[model samples]
Target: MKLYTWLSAPNPRRALIFVAEKAIDIDIEEASDPDNPGQLSKRYCEKYPHRRVPLLELDDGDWIAEAAAVCKYLEALYPDNPLFGRNAKEAALIEMWDRLAEWEGLMAVSEVFRNTHRLFVGRGLAGYDIQIPQISELAERGKLRLGRFFNKIDERLDQNEYLAGDIFSFADITALCAIDFSLSRKLIIPENCCNVKRWYQAVSERPSAIG
Candidate 1:
């Protein structure tokens, strides 16, 4: 399998952490910049219709998009050192929060990045610039939720080293990436969020985090 990636994207970082955690060695291909028109060129778009990075191209020629799905596939492939949950209840809870973290947490953070970030210059067009009244309202609500999310995760981590359970699941990596991205993209919890800050430090120190 070959994984297409980008250097600085948070979405790809999700897969990066997963593969690193599992110590899975797969062929890596760097995707051309999304900002560059070449991304949508015939060759790349054929390999990945979404025209996004972090694509997993299976040897059979099937392509897997989305970071979570890629993580799930990797977890299934290498179960000795697991990242997803182990059992039924564990799986449900872990996936639930993972979905929430990706949807509510990461999505909102990404909006702040793509829309508010200056690097998006020519890219932040129609879909990127469009304002949803709900997200705008939620952006305010998200500020409070961000605190709650941090507080909840921090409290959880206080008891166990990882989020979801004693194990370090993808949820931890997802939350970690989201929180780190928030520093540059959206409203970050100030240093006063002691537990959150402490938890982030731990996550940051992980060897996989460098990926």
Candidate 2:
């Protein structure tokens, strides 16, 4: 199997972290130029029309696009580390928290970055060539949503060691990536969010995080 990824982006970082934690030995290929955010090579665009990174290509020629899906596939193949979960209940909890992290945390950061960054002036959305105008209102709304997300996660983290539970799972990976990605927009965990700060420090120090 081969992993097509862009290391500079948060989405691919999720997969890379998973790979490091699992110690998977799959071949990796760069799908995008790190300096150029959304510009995909003609060959890459032709092969994967979605034009997204962190894609997993199976030896059989099947491709998995989303970051979560890519991690899921790797987890299935390399189940020893088990980042998803060990049981049905754990799986459900991990899934719920992972979705929340993606929808509430990562998407919020993306909204602000895509709508306000000059680099994305004519391309407000991903995986498309159509010119979508940036909306200042959306960026403002995203900041509000991001603030709420940080508070919610801090509350949750106060009661649990990781996002899903006592164990470190894929949910934590998503949340960590989202939190780090927000830095580009000058968004950060509030000084009073002590729980989140502690959680972030622990996760960021992990060896896999360097991936």
Top-scoring candidate (lDDT): 2
Residues 103-151, model 1: lDDT tens digits: 6666767655554444454543222223333334544555665666676
RMSD per candidate (Å) reads 3.7, 1.5
Error of 1 at 137 (Å): 8.0
Indicate the TM-score of model 2.
0.95
**How do all models score by TM-score?**
0.81, 0.95
Candidate 1 Cα lDDT to native:
0.72
In candidate 1, list every pair of residues with a backbone clash: none
Report the C-alpha displacement of residue 21, candidate 1, in angstroms. Answer: 0.9
Q: Number of clashing residue pairs in every model?
A: 0, 0
Error of 1 at 194 (Å): 2.3
